[model samples]
Structures are given as structure tokens and as C-alpha cells.
Target: MERIRLTGAQATMLATLYGKAMDARSPNSVLHDTMALEAVRRIDHDFSKVGIKPGDASTVALRSLHFDGWTREFLAAHPEATVLHLGCGLDTRVFRVDPGPGVRWFDVDYPDVIDLRRKVFPEREGDYTLLATPVTPAGWLAQVPADRPVLVVAEGLTMYLREEAGRELFRAIVERFPSGQLVFDGFSKRGIKLQKVNKAVQVAGATLYWGVDGPAELESIHPALRCVSAVSAFDLDGFDRVRLAYRLLAKAARMIPVMRRMAIMYRLEF
Candidate 1:
């Protein structure tokens, strides 16, 4: 088994990984991600330290499904597009989506995280690549051919970056790709200040720096950028499938505007 020594925000990935695995094991699994289940069995880390509660599994699964749906939507229309999964940390999205042969997929993250990924996940086929880097204004983005329509997905990443850096990262991608979509989930400013609410972030003792209050915050960045969708947690397609406890929590959150803004998923076209 592969042992891990990641800490801080990087260590938080393990919590999310564990949650997805638990979700996949459930009878009414949201993602039905057997890949995540396999990954947990292969890792030798102490998941208890990550502080993933039973209820957290469905939240992780639903978030992944939301992104996966958008990815499938894009690929169904443009089967030959390029996909850049930024801050990819042990996520089996490529395995789950299983894009067509004409597609080019890149799973990118920090060098150490990429190294851990190789240890746990087996080799894959297709025009797939894993680029390991710090993912700032990510110089590695330059390596990806800008010729095709791009689909950029960043999960649980932007909060770790300073607000300016997050915008800059998006700026780089929009400037490089002629036309494409940027899909990601982000916290409201209130959410960033209340990081203790996120079990993984609390357990990892990680600091979160940025908050995306709404789609207009990013759409203002570039002339070509347009907000395609800005969905709150309650608005996700599979809300009814989420466990009862979280469904109740979402109900209560909806009563308050600040709580409602705590979690949001955004998709933009440029």
C-alpha cells in the first residue's frame, strides 16, 4: 500500500477522497465511483485524522457529479475538445467520464500529489497526461495546445489561492484558449471567513484566502467571459438524492442569504 505524508491544504484532498469512497460504497451512491473505492483500499493513510463524518460523503459525491455532468455535456457536443483538470488531487474524473479517443485530458496538481496519484492509480489509456506543478499562474498551462476548445475544471482549489491569484489563473486560461468553458465551485466571502464549517479544512488546519461571491465577479475580468450558470448547493440537479440530514441543512441555509451563498458552483464560457 502507498503511505502519504501530505499536510495543510494538500492533506485535505485525502478527506474529500475518503468521502467519495464512502459515497461509492453506499447503496444509493451518487457518483457510483468504484475507482474512488479502489483508491481508498490501496492507500495506507490514517483517514481518521482527516475528520470525514458520515454525512460528508454525499456532499463530495454530488459536487463531483455536478462537474461531471457539465463535462459530459461539453464532450457530447465537442467530442474532440481538450480538458484541463486543474488542482486534480487523486480524483478519478477521467476514469468516471471516460472521454472519447479524440479527446485530450490533463490531470494537473502539485508534484508531490501527482507522485502519490501514480502510486495509487494504475496507468491509463487514451491521449491523457498528468502535469505536476504548483498551479499558480501555472506556467504548465503554456504546454497545453490552445488549438482546441478547452474545458477547465477546478475543484476545491480556488479558496487556497489569494483572490488575485485565482483571477490571474483564470485570466491565463481564457487568454490562451480561443473559446471554452471554466467550471468550478467556490465559497462566498462569508464562507471563507467561516472555514471551520468545512470538516476537511478544519481537520487539515488549512488557510483559505479567496472567495467568489457571484458570477459577475469573474465575468467582469474579460470581454469574452460570460456567466453560463451560477448554481447554489440547493440548485444542484441531484439535491433530492442527498442524505436527509444535509437536505434539512440546505433547507435551513436557504432561509438566510449568507448561508445560501456559502457554497456555489459556477460555469463560464469565453
Candidate 2:
């Protein structure tokens, strides 16, 4: 089968799907996320089809669930705030969030992803808009309301970006919105090195370029940005319900911080 030509960021969405599917034994958002994973898994790419191993699949599911929990918590508290899902890929967060009457939602991604999203998801009728532009592009921010509080979600995205690009993107977001929150997952140096050796990651063209050793580093990039919560996959309480092997692995990872590294979410105010 001929392989599909997907950018590194685009491929990361596939990884998200694969991960979600692996953890579908529960009644959480993972069940909904599995839809996208199943869609991509059926595609004719060799790496997506055969190269993905059990471990890689587990990682994706865990990360997706973590993001889903964070998003739910954030949206529940700030019903009036606008949501900017950077690198939105094929996620159905709008449906999951089910924004109330006053809430605004925006899904931003590459043209191809946005175009594909249009076909996969329902049209946004009220305060939602789908913007087809790269996350780093200056023009995309113009479409969003500068005065409203915005919540930006960047999942499985920053790792592909060079450190400077990621920093600049964060700075631009904080400067663009007067008061908002930015939730993203970060890769540690050890996690990046692990990806280099992982066959599935190599075949997918995901090369980790940005790894913040600590969440405090984000504060230095922009003073307004506060490190409200720094969570690792191991720290999440949900892991206790997982299978024995997964729970054990999560426990061991916590013992050796570098084993799984950390993924964090931040709140930025200007």
C-alpha cells in the first residue's frame, strides 16, 4: 500500500488516535478519541499500520486522556472564555466540551487538517470557527478576539517545533490575548532520546526538537505566563485503575523521573 505523505505534526495526531484506541476499555473520553485513531489506523501507511508497537500505542492513549481531563476542567470553570485548539488535527473536542450559549470555540491547524476536519466534524453554528492556518502564522491570531480570555490547547505539537519557534509562539499568544490560559504537553530530553530509538516514532517522522527540562523555563519566556500545574503521566490518579502492567510501569517511571519525563499545562495572564 502506498503511504500517505503527512507532516510531522499531522502524524502526531495519528499517534494520538492509536493511543486512545489502546485504552478504550473505560468509559472516559478515550472512547470518543478512539474514533480518530480507528480512522487513521485503517489508512494504508506501513508505519501507521505495522510499525506501531504496543508501548507506543499505550503512550498515545495515556496522553490523550490526560489532555481530555485538563480540557474538561478548564472549560467547565471558564464558560465564557474562547478556546483555541492549536494543532487541532482530527479531534472532536468541540463535541466533547459542548460549549454553552456564550462560549466560543476555534479549531486551528494546517490547511489540509482543517479541510479534512470539515469533512469529519459538524459545522460550527454559533460562536465556533475553524481556521485553516499554521499555528505559527501571525494571521491566525487576528481572527480571534483579542480582548476575550482564550484557552489554548497544544497537544503533541511543540515537540516538532524548534525551541525558538515554540518560545516565539507562546510569547505571541500571551501578547495577543490579554488574559488566557495555555495548556500544552512538553517532552523531556530523555523522552526525546527515547523517540529517536522508537521505530514507530522514526517511521512517523516525529523528531523531538523542543524539550523544556522544567516548567519554570516557560515563565522566563514570558513573565505573565505562570506555571499553575505541572503534571506527569505517572502523577495522574487515573493510572491506578489501569491494568497491573501499566500501573507498575507508571509507578516505576515515577521512581526514575527520566523514564517517562513530564508533561505540563500552564496559565498565562497579561
Candidate 3:
């Protein structure tokens, strides 16, 4: 494959794919995203520049597990619901989740990223659609059907956007869908600061723009939305061996007020 020049946000797709690929190879992996592994093998880029360290791969898997778990719960409640995967990279989440025949799924991202996805993955028409558009400014939201309850998910996104832009994006989703849920992972102020020196961010040349100290504060983004739950990454399960590592570090982290607010996952309803 020829090398592709990508902006910071677009380059992030590669890092995420690397992380998922690493998790899939692990014996005790939680995400098991084989598609990601295959996609990485087929892509001709030098993945070494992405800076996906072993611990970073574990973090990605843990976050993916949270989103996957929440999605399953939502689908169970509304089997016919439409699922919108915001900033859908080459992670192959649809393949991993397999929401069954009743649901319609749309993967939205930048046009170039979507083009790459089409080339690498087998096309699944009718039930699955690949949409290419900028997530913020949200012009693409008009294309998604809003009549049915929707489950919108954004993983490893949001942090790259300014607070105002991120709020507009969330507000658009809540306004477009009469009833739905929005799930996403966000960094705290401290996380944003730490990201500046994070190897992956350094390699990708990306900036972390938005971070929330408390996940519940995301509710302020839109009047129609309310936070269902906000939990720390350390509180969630599926960490496997890392759970112990997190616990041991928990006390040390708490000593630093900023580190305590590093990462969190949120479930919200509108």
C-alpha cells in the first residue's frame, strides 16, 4: 500500500487499529477484534510511527470493552434501534459486536478514512452503511434516520475537539433523535495535559483539546440529554491483569488530584 498523508485526527485511526490488533493477538484479550489485526496486516504503512506501546494496547481494549458492553445492553432493550458509530476507524467494531439482523448500523468518519475502510473490508450493504463526513459541525447527522431510538458511540474521539465544537456535536445528536443514548470516553483536564507527552499523541502530532473532570458534566452539552452513568476507567471491569496494576497505582494517583480525573466512560440518554 502507498503511504498516505493524514492530518492528526486521521492518523489516529492507525494508532487505534494497532491497539485493537495487539489486543486480538493476546490470549486473554477482551476485545478480540480480529478484523483490526487483519486490516493492519494489509495496510502498507509503517505502524511503528503510531507509537502503540503494549500498555496503550491494553488501554484501548479496556475502553472498547466498555463501549461494547454498553452497546449490547442498549440493543437488548431496543433490538431494532439504529447504531451510529461516530469517528468509525478501522477497528471492526460492527464485526465484533454483531448486533444481529434487526439493527441498522452506520459507520461515519472522514471521507479518506471511509475510503480506506472500503478497500480493506468486504462491503456489507443494506444493513451496514459507511458514511464519510466530518463528525463535528455535524452535517452528516441529517442523513441518519432519527425515527428510531439510536445508540451513538464515540471512542478515542472528543478529546481532539474544542469544547464548543464537541458540545455542538452532542447537541445535534440529542436534537436529531427524539429518544436515544450516547456513549463515549473522555479524558479529564489532567489527561489532556498528560496527552501532550504521550508517545502516541506525539507520533501522530495530535492535540487533546477537550477534557472533563467529571463525566456527568457532559450533560451540560445539551438540555435534552441527561447522564445515565459516569464511571472511572479504574472502576470498570475487563482489565484482566491490568486491574491489579491499576489498583496498586490507585493510591498514588489519588494523591495527585489531577491524575485522579484522568479517564472516564459515560452513558447518557436523551
Instruction: Write model 2 residue lDDT over 1-270, tens digit each, in one string.
Output: 223567565766655555555555345433455555454555555444534554445456656666777777776887778888888887766776677876788888988877766655557678889888888755668778876778888877787788898898888888888787888888776666667665555666767788777767888999888887778767765575556787888888889867656554444444
The local distance difference test score of each candidate is 0.88, 0.70, 0.82
Query: Between the candidate structures 2 and 3, which one is better when assessed by TM-score?
Result: 3
Model 1, residue 46: distance off in Å is: 1.4
- lDDT score, candidate 1, position 147: 88
Q: Where in model 3 is the C-alpha error above 4 Å?
A: 243-247, 254-257
How much is the lDDT of residue 133 in candidate 3? 88
Q: Rank order by lDDT, top first?
A: 1, 3, 2
The residue-by-residue lDDT of candidate 1 on 1-270, one tens digit each, is: 888888888988998899899998899899998888899899898787788866678888999998999999999988889999988999999999999998999999989999999988989988999999878966888889998999999988888998888888888999998899999888988889888777688888788999888888989878889998888876677778777987888888888888888889889999
Best by TM-score: 1
Q: Which candidate tops lDDT?
A: 1
Pitting candidate 1 against candidate 2, the one with the higher lDDT is 1
TM-score of every prediction relative to native: 0.97, 0.85, 0.92
Clashing residue pairs for model 3? none
Candidate 1: lDDT of 229? 88
